[model samples]
Target: MSQTLDLSSAPAILFLFGLSGSGKSYVGNLIGELTGCYVYHADDDITDEMILALQEKRPFTNEMRDRYFPIITEKILHLRQHHNFLVVTQAVYKQRHREYLCKNIPNMEMIFIDASDAVISQRLTTRNGGITGASALALRRDFEQPDSNIKVILNEGDKSMLVTQLNNYFSSAQPEKD
Candidate 1:
């Protein structure tokens, strides 16, 4: 038996998570375009203080993340009320954080986006702004890899391959005739 992600019956909320420069945002945007769901970048909820800390090469402490999760949860809940389906991008590196979001949201699916260190480095070099270099490395060092149960999408330097994989993973199913 083959597992299929039926876009027609996709969850109310979808989360794309991984390291910075791993292409979570790109994947989330693509999913939104394909499914016509609203896309939300969780970074948008980042406070200026968090931005400064990141800019100063400081990774967020679990306590900080704990406080942060509620804000994101609230935003997601608000967005859920308006959109039938939603795609969200966040570097939910810790399993606890993923669990927190999952507990608060209904019918949500989380997919991990992965890439080689080389690919991440190359992508970071071209990025205009956002977490990069030491900041990114710190996050990677602190990242708690999700357990085997979570789905993984490898994005190794090829946009076409990524697109093909995503397209294959999510397919629209036609309604059955009576």
Candidate 2:
């Protein structure tokens, strides 16, 4: 079965959430390029303390995320005022965090980037930066899967396949005719 994304409303905020190596950043950038939307990597908002914690192989506690989420949401809100469309990439592992973002950014649309364990492992191993090893394991164990109603993009194949999937998903939408 094929998945279709309804872009009729042209969401103000496109939130892409997933595991560390699930291709959220790649897909978000592609979406931004294809749609002329601004891409904001939420990881850029991570505090130095959080970076140190990750560097030490410590998984972030809910309290840590609680302190961090507000920063991201605030920036997103501020950016939305300037840009009509925004593609945001963040590993929103907790359901409550997702809910908080939705409540704070009412026009946001959440899309989950789905990738198998083997694929994620391979990607993380080859990637130069971001979470990996024990931190990645902790994230996988702690991740709270979102509700089934949310849209998903399975990124198990090669980059071309992933791009094809995104292209089909985005190209199916009818562009506004001025």
Best by TM-score: 1
TM-score of 2: 0.86
Off by over 4 Å in 1: 1-6, 157-160, 172-178
Which residue pairs overlap in candidate 2's backbone? none
lDDT tens digits, residues 66-171, model 2?
9999999999999989998888999999999999999989788898999988988888889887787678887687799989998888977755666566555455
Give residue 25's error in model 2 in angstroms: 0.2
Candidate 2: 10-residue stretch with minimal lDDT: 1-10
Candidate 1 lDDT over 1-178, as tens digits, reads 1333346545778799999999999888866665577999999998777888898898888878888889999999999999988999999888999998998898998889999889999999899987777899888888989889987889874555665565455546444559
Show model 2 residue runs off by greater than 4 Å: 1-8, 158-178
Candidate 1's TM-score reads 0.87
* lDDT, residue 64, candidate 1: 80
